[model samples]
Target: MRELERYYRVLELEPGASLDEVNQAYKDLAFVWHPDRMPQDNQRLKDKAVSKLQQINEARDKLRSHKARLHVPSTRAASQSASNPTSQQTTTSKTTSRQAYSSQSRTPQEPSYQPPKPHPDLTGKDYSGANLTNRDFSGRNMSYANLKGANLSDTFMHKVNLFGADLSEANLFRANLLLADLREANLQSANLIGADLSGADLRGADLRGARVMIGDRVQVKLIGALLNGAIMPDGSIHE
Candidate 1:
């Protein structure tokens, strides 16, 4: 498995290295294997790297604890550390101390860390009334999809494919939709106030009753879009 090979490469010792050597090797290998330093798109590789790091940590723990010193000590140590009451107590105490120190040394945890979901490949699929506010759907293929009444406020959809999509009554307030393909899309009554539509294709698209402004000055200036029946920024209705 890739996991086994990664662990072996990280330790740099033969397949039967002592736990002490593995720990020392981990200290050296961590510099290059740290997940934060790795490329973002290589998440699976970084996860494997982290798993190997954990194995090194387990190897060191087994050696120090004087438990069974098998060739693959990490696997056995983890099981023992989990099942043994003394080891569990020691682990709990250390964790509690670390937590107390961390509380003082670090800032409080942020409320929640729900990462933005990746855009679904829903090209030509009907997604009417979908609540996708403040989501990043940039540069995705969503052409010919029915997105009527969708809440897409403040969404980042730059250079996305939206040709012939039904975006009628959709909330696109302050959205960054620059260079997007929206030809023949039904944008009638769509709330596009403050949305950036620079270089976007809107030929034959319905702009009837669409709100295209925010305040006295246009928050999002439409560079090359239709203005038929759309509300202008200066409160003057576009004919």
Candidate 2:
């Protein structure tokens, strides 16, 4: 058995779990195995608590990615349908019918399957200049994380908390950053072309010299958000 196996047992779940089951399991186990719940008298127990927390976080990430992959095909189809809106609907209907039949043929009371875990120490790590294109970071708490100069083209960051994060010079072209909190974040010289910033809290964020397209829809909350030196989609500068 692996070291993380102990953590899986603590959560009373197998290592290979589906995303839905991973979310539910994390909620249940966090209530019991939280560091606050453990006594601080023994150093060994405290260490164990830390290890368990890392394991749980890793498991959740793995499951989330696995679940996200399952929806990719459907997403691509939907994107195509949005462009055509005619022939794709017929194909979609047939596919949906086949999927319904497949689901019914499967076991009625199906248990959730577990997926692989992620690296334990990914949070707050420096990921400068990394290629993170088309990645999903939805609902993740990445406060104070350093993503400077990272390539995040076409990524999805919906509702992610990025307070005080460093994202300077990052490439966020065509990214969906809807409802993300970028308070006090450093986004100097970052690319926001075609990025959806609707409902984003950009309070105290540095947008000086940032490349922002005018065609992209951005609902700015703060008054002092710098519009100078921003490149609009109309091929004009947002002065």
Candidate 3:
């Protein structure tokens, strides 16, 4: 059965497309959906770009592998031919039986490999106290997400929209949160050791009692971030 239709659809081509066609189609779509072309502030477009690029890559690979496999000789057919040279000259009555055997030995129909489903949509979702260590949540819209007491250590959250999200008591050790919009976020008692918050928007964010220091030295990075009305790691607040 032809299970390659999905690949063709991804490439915007009809079934029975040549291998060359698939390669060209992937290039065309990737160029159009690439995230670099989108505006820096457009988080929605960037997320879409990441998901689209992944699908295009998978489609091209599946089609190319299938084509390559078709060219390889069947080991079972070759072995049968070598073992039954005398039987190859079968009578007319036995010719039908050989044809049936050859058909049975044909290459099996293998399903194409599809990548696992993408991460769940976290838009305004409640995930308080979730252990989400080392996860990649870059370029996502997690506005108002309830992340209180969540372990987000080493997570990638670049350019994410976490406006009004509750990140109280979250562990963000060594996390990459560059250029994230954390306006009005609650970071009370969160462990931000070695976390990068460069170019982030911390306007009105509450960071009181946050673990942002290591032996009197600040372990958090906040270069180019907006801190209007934000509470500092200490008891004082930023005017």
lDDT tens per residue, model 3, 64-149: 88877766556676457545646556576466656766666665563334544876668789888898986768888999999999
- Can you give the lDDT of residue 111 in candidate 1? 32
Using alpha carbons, what is the TM-score of model 3? Answer: 0.55
Error of 2 at 111 (Å): 13
Compared with the true structure, all predictions reach lDDT values of 0.67, 0.65, 0.82
Q: Which residue pairs come into collision in candidate 1? A: none
Residue 179's C-alpha lDDT in candidate 3?
A: 84
Per-residue C-alpha lDDT of model 2 across residues 1-239, encoded as one tens digit per residue = 37445545545678755556667687555434545334546678768877877777776665566556654422344445345444546877767765665565455344344445762434576878999986667677887889999998877776677887888899988776667788777888888776666567776666665776455555322222334443333435555
Residue 223 in model 2: lDDT: 26
lDDT of 1 by residue, 58-124 (tens): 6555443432322121234334443444544676686665556545443343232333487678788
lDDT of 1: 0.67
Every model's TM-score: 0.45, 0.43, 0.55
Model 3 stretches with alpha carbons more than 4 Å out: 1-109, 113-120
Best by lDDT: 3
RMSD of each: 17.4, 19.1, 11.7
Q: Which rank order by TM-score, best down to worst?
A: 3, 1, 2
lDDT of 3: 0.82
Model 2: lDDT to the true structure: 0.65
Error of 2 at 62 (Å): 19
